[model samples]
Target: MSKILLVEARLHLRDGASLLFTIALPLMLLVFLGRAAGPAFPALMVMLSVLTLSFTVLPTVLATYRHQGVLRRMSTTPVSPLRVLAVQLLINLVVAVVSTGLLMAFGPGLPRNLPGFLLVFVLGTAALMAMGLVIAALAPNGKAAPTIGSAVMFPLMFVSGMWVPREYLPEVVRVIGDYSVAGPFARALGDTWVGQAPHLPHLLVLAVGLVVSGALAVRVFRWE
Candidate 1:
């Protein structure tokens, strides 16, 4: 497990240029936008919201393995497929922590509240991880990975309140975005990062989505 985790971690850090782009580019964007937006941006809140994708990396990577038959090869060995999945998840988590550390190096100063912020962070993480599994299950192949990733990510960025705060969006977009998985995710994460309430709707939608997605992943997943 440790070996697999180490290998996956290194791959993401080194070979996975796309992962770096997804992670670092956003941080840079947050920094620029946070500065540009001034008090308008809510830096910590938006920064925390990016973690949704970072956390999902493990699932996506695992999907790559499944789509490529790497998972199937691992299954023929003594190592259990479940263990491989566990290690991949652990690697992704490490990446998330490391990524968070890099962001906090210039965290743009957190808001006064701590507890409310933490709740949203935890909940947002859960939602993101669940979505990752859904993608892993649904994606057709390695070539499809990036497409699926972007499809999920783009909407989350726009609808979830990350791109434009809910208050700023037009009523129709806001109404739709408000209930969207990403919007609530952003709302919950935004609130928590700034030390606010759980934004229950966001967390609940995510929770429900995870449950549904997880079931689908199990149904469709192949070691190969």
Candidate 2:
């Protein structure tokens, strides 16, 4: 497992474009939108980073591996192909932590409710990644994975107030956003950032998303 992790890490590092986009894009956006977003800026930036990893990077890598027969071949070895999926998840999590660390070091401000922030962060990230796993499981091939993920990601981002503030969105859209994974994640993190406990409904939405998406991914995922 350790060897697989090391090899996978090295392979991931070779994808220079992905690394740059995942780490640099959010910081660059912060530079332009920091003052405008005010207190919500850091949370928005962190959410963007997390969403990018969960929707774009993760599914693409896993689907590509399966499409290339990598996962299929792994079945012949001592290691289970599932370990590769786990490693990929771990690597993406590390990237997310680094991105968040950078935001803390250089962004507008840190979350005031540290414990609550961590709790929301964990649940939100897990839920989002579980959805990504479902994308990886269902996508027909590498070429289709990013297409499917982006289709799902963009609408969620829109409703989550990535482009427009939730206060500005229509009441119907806001209600739907409350139930979406990204929406709850954004709201929960924003609440925690301002030193408030996350709303109970937002936590429940995230937990439910994690369970449903995780079970679906495990049930439908194929080595090939």
Candidate 3:
């Protein structure tokens, strides 16, 4: 497992595009948009990092591995195919953590409610990653994964107030955003960023999303 993890981490490092998008892009956006975003800036940066990994990086890598027979080859080895999936998840989790640290260190401010922020971050990331796994499971080929992921990502981002402030969104849209995983995740992080405990409803939504999406991904995922 350790050997596979090290090898996979090296491969991920070599994917310059994914590294730039996942780590560098968020920081760049923060420099340009932080003032406009106000206190929510850190939350937005964190969300951007998470979404990039969940929608763009995770699914694309898994789908590409499947398409190129990497997973199949692993299945034939002594190592379990499931171990690869776990390793990928761990690697992405580390990236997200590092991204968050950078945002807090170099960006505008720290998360005021550290414990609450951590709680929301964990549930939210797991839920989003589970959704990405679903995309990976359903994608027909490597090329199709990003297409499908982007299709899903943009709408969720809009609803989550990535493009527009939540205060400015239509009432109907706000309500829909409240229930969406990205929505609650954003709101929860925002709450914690400002020193408030995350809303119970947001936490519940994320928890439910994690359970349902995780189950679906497990059921639908293919080793080959």
Clashes of each: 4, 0, 0
Report the lDDT tens digits of candidate 1 across residue range 1-224: 77876776677777455455545665676677766754425533344434445434555677778877887887889888888877765666555555555555665665435566555555555556666766777777666765776776776677556666667877888877766666776666555555566756766776776577667766776677
Question: Which residue pairs does candidate 1 place in steric collision?
Answer: 117-192, 117-195, 160-182, 160-183
**Tens digit of per-residue lDDT, candidate 2, span 66-88:** 99999999889988898999999
Residue lDDT tens for model 3, 101-175: 988888876889999999999999999999999999999888999899999999999999988998999999999
Q: Rate the local accuracy (lDDT) of all candidates.
A: 0.62, 0.90, 0.93
In model 2, pairs of residues that clash are none
RMSD of each: 2.9, 1.0, 1.0
Query: What lDDT, from 0 to 1, does candidate 2 have?
Result: 0.90
**TM-score of every model?**
0.82, 0.97, 0.97
Return the lDDT, model 3, position 103: 88
Clashing residue pairs for model 3:
none
